[model samples]
Target chain A: SAVISQKPSRDICQRGTSLTIQCQVDSQVTMMFWYRQQPGQSLTLIATANQGSEATYESGFVIDKFPISRPNLTFSTLTVSNMSPEDSSIYLCSAECSGNTIYFGEGSWLTVV
Target chain B: SQQGEEDPQALSIQEGENATMNCSYKTSINNLQWYRQNSGRGLVHLILIRSNEREKHSGRLRVTLDTSKKSSSLLITASRAADTASYFCAPFSSNTGKLIFGQGTTLQVKP
Candidate 1:
């Protein structure tokens, strides 16, 4: 299992502003991903962070809105662009380890006012 | 990716009791994982069971995977107040390599 750390664990932002959440893994991982949990709903896959390449976004998530960058195997960032009140959610970063077991970070909780 | 369906949207039990939750997936999976999330907090990986394995135990948590039925179950023996949280099940082995999370079962352990 890999240890994941996320920055800006909790933050409050104004509508229309953008917030970038950083994720750092203790060791190199084969796969990195971003997930969003809105209010009481279950977490949804936002994108798959590919090192040295463009991230693959999931349905209902656009790169323009939730841009992700993975400069290396151990680090990635997710930026919520043009945020709205509806964009308030807990953003989580995860890495897949051996045997397809994934570990999650503490998560970045963003509240858009 | 197939999403898992968790049985019993919510559950309440007394301390020292055993808590059980079931999850069913629509597709075959290489691994199944159970996660716990405290209120407004991050996800905690509880246990992971592979398709080839039938049952696994870690401390007070026991997880069983039934690949033939595409379902799994998590049982927590001797539940405590700290065990109160949201339990979610996710099945791995998707062609897309993305994890689909179930709505989760909210477990409340009253002390």
Candidate 2:
């Protein structure tokens, strides 16, 4: 199991502003992923952050809206650009460790007003 | 679109009883995993059952998979109030390593 930490556990931002969430893992991981959970809904994969490369985004999500950066193997960041009220959701970062099991950060809850 | 769907959106059970949640997926998967999440927190991995395996267990949690039907079930025995949380079943595609999560079953264990 990996000990993962995410900054800005909860934040309230004004519409049109941007919020960047940080994810730090205890050790180097093979892959890192970002997910969004809307209230009362299932999680949606936003993108996969690969170290030293551009993030790979899923369908219905674009790089412009959710830009990601992975400076190293143990750290990654997801920035929600030009945010709106609809963008309010809990953003979670996860990493795949040994045994094909994935561990998640505590999550950053963002509320866009 | 989501690959898996869990049955019984919500469930209320008494402590010491057993709670079971079912999940059905759309495509082939290398493995299926169950996760638990407390309110406003990240998900915690519970157990993983591979496509070749029928069942797996960890502590008090048991998971069974049926690849022919593309479905799975999670059973929590001797439930406790601390077990109250949302349970999700995720299937991983070996080709992508992306886990597709289900809607989740919210279980409330009453003490």
Candidate 3:
């Protein structure tokens, strides 16, 4: 399995400020997924980041609010824009490996006050 | 509604006892996987059961998949206090790596 690392493990930002979380994988992968877990909630798929293309967002997520960028196969970034208190949650990134297994990053915890 | 949903959102058991968590999905999946999350940390992959496989085991964890019913169950034998965590089932196998995680079952194993 591939090892994933996420930057800014935890952060506190003021409302209306945006924060970008970065995810890096040890090896190049074809697809990277971003997920959001609100306090006391399950993980929700935010978007799919594929290198060299626009990200595919889930129904409730918008590119403007949660913009994603995957400049290459091994790295991707998710930015929470125009943040609000409601945006406080844990953001995680995962990469798919051989045998259909997925590995997750430590996750970035964001708090909008 | 999410594709995968887990039953008994929370569970409590005694150490050395067995713990079981069930998950049901709405769509056909190529494979199902179980993951464990400790408190506020990232998820750790526990086991993966392919659609064609009935059961799989890893260490103290056992996972069973029933494609006919679109459901899966995770069993932890000889449960320990360290097993207390949120267990989630993810539907993987689609060409897209994006996975739909179930609501998850919070298991608390009292020592």
Candidate 4:
């Protein structure tokens, strides 16, 4: 099992500002992922945070908007740049430990005004 | 885009009643997992059923996966008010180790 922690639990930011959410895992994990959950919706994978290389983002998402950095096996950061009202969502960080079970952080709730 | 779709987006039942939720996916998967989220907070993994397995049980929760139909069902027996939350199904890809989540079903277990 993995214990995940996220910083800035809830924040209200103005439009056009950027916010960086940090995720820290208790143990080194092979896979780390970022997901976004809009109001009253399911989680959408933002990107896969690779340890030593660029992140792999899903379709409809790009590095320019959601830049991810995975400096090591236990730490990663996701930056929501040039934010807008549409970017208001809950961002979650999850890590896959062992092989099957995935653990999630409390999540960072960002509200753009 | 997510790979699964859950039926009965919302459910309301008594605390002692049982609750059942179903999920259907479009693609082949290595395993299917159930997760519960409380009021839009973090997600807690409930149970996981591999493609080769048909049914699995964890305490009061029972999960069944049918690979032939690409569907799965989760049953919570004798639920409590604490069980009120949104439930989601995630299809895991063995090749990539990625999980795709469905919309989710909101269960309201009134005490």
Candidate 5:
């Protein structure tokens, strides 16, 4: 198991602005992922953060909207650009550790006005 | 696209009773995992059952998987008020590291 942390545990942002959520892991991990949980709904994968390379985004999500950066094994960031009320959701960062078990950060709850 | 769907979107149960949630997936998977999330919080991993295994237990939680039917169930015994949260089932594909999450079941345990 790994200890994961995210910054700005909760934030209220204005529309047309941007907020970047940071995720830090206690140890180096092979893969880091970003997910969004819409209100009253399930999680949707936004992208996969790969160390030293471009992130792989899922369908319905774009790099321009949700750009990701994984400079090292233990750190990554996801920025939601031009925020809107519809973008208000709980953003979670996760890592796949040993035995293929996944661990998640406490999550960054963003509320766009 | 999402791969799993859990039945009984919302459940209310008394403390000390048992709560069960069911999940069904579309494709074959190497492993399926159950996770719990408090309102407005991130998810916590509960347990994982591999395709080759039928059932697994951890503390008060039991998970059973049927690969042939592509479905799974999670049973929580002696539920408590603190157990009130949403539960989700995620199936990980062996080929891609992607994990498809279910719609989730909201369980409210009354004290």
Candidate 6:
């Protein structure tokens, strides 16, 4: 099992500002992903944080808005740039471990003011 | 497109009662996974059932997958107030190598 931890558990930022959420895994993981959950909504995959390369983003999400950095197998970071009220949401970091089970970190709660 | 839509958008049940949530997908999948989130917090993986498997159990949680019907169900028996949360089903398609999430079922277990 992998223990994934995230930082900045809760924060309120001003519009136009950016916030970076950090994720650290206890063990090396092959796959790491970022997801967003807006108010009263389910999670939506933001991007796949790939180590040593650019992240793979899903449709409706772009690198310019959500830049991701996976420096190693155990650490990754996601930045929500040029934030807006629409960007206020819970950002989650997850890693697929134990073959089939995926573990998630206690998400970062960001509220844009 | 490996997402599953959850049924009964919201459910309200008393403590000790059983809560069942259903998910239906549009395409075939290799496996189906269930996750829970409390008060919009991070997700906790509850259980996973492979397409070939019919049923799986973990503690008070039971998951059943019916590939022929392209649907799955999650049953939480003897639920408690702590079990009040949103439940989601993620269908994994080997073709995409990822899981897509749909709007989840919000279960409110009243104490």
Off by over 4 Å in 5: none
Question: What local lDDT score does residue B110 receive in model 6, on the 0 to 100 scale?
Answer: 94
Report the lDDT tens digits of candidate 5 across residue range A8-72. 89999999999999999999999999999989888999999999899999989999999999999
Put down candidate 4 lDDT per residue, A58-103, tens digits, no spaces.
9999999999999999999999999999999999999998757788
Name the 10 consecutive residues with the lowest summed lDDT in model 4 chain B: B1-10
Q: How would you encode candidate 5's per-residue C-alpha lDDT over B1-103 as one tens digit per residue?
A: 3378998899999999999999998887889989999988889999989889999999999999998888999999999999999999998876887787877
Ten-residue region with minimum lDDT total, candidate 6 chain A = A95-104
Query: Which model is ahead, 2 or 5, in terms of TM-score?
Result: 5
- Local distance difference test, candidate 4: 0.92
Candidate 3 stretches with Cα past 4 Å from truth are none
Superposed model 1: Cα runs more than 4 Å off: none
In model 2, the Cα lDDT at residue B41 comes to: 90
Q: Return model 6's CA RMSD, one decimal.
A: 1.2
The CAPRI classification for model 5 reads as high
Tens-place lDDT per residue, model 3, A1-113, is 78999999999999999999999999988889999999999899899897898999989999999999999989999999999999999999999888778999999999999
Candidate 4 Cα outliers beyond 4 Å, as residue runs? none
Off by over 4 Å in 2: none
Top-scoring candidate (TM-score): 1
For model 3 the TM-score comes to 0.96
DockQ of each: 0.88, 0.83, 0.88, 0.83, 0.85, 0.82
Candidate 6, which segments miss by more than 4 Å at Cα?
none
Q: After aligning candidate 5 to the native by TM-score, how far in Å is the CA of B68 from where it should be?
A: 1.1
TM-scores, all candidates, are 0.98, 0.96, 0.96, 0.96, 0.97, 0.96
Q: What TM-score would candidate 6 get against the native?
A: 0.96
Name the lDDT value of residue A16 in candidate 3: 98
TM-score of candidate 3's A chain against the true A chain: 0.98
Question: On residues B1-111, what C-alpha lDDT tens digit does candidate 3 reach at each position?
Answer: 225788779999999999999999877788888899999999998888999999998989888999898899999999999999999988875765568887799999999
B30-49: candidate 2 lDDT, tens digit per residue:
88888999998999988988
Report lDDT per candidate.
0.93, 0.92, 0.91, 0.92, 0.93, 0.91
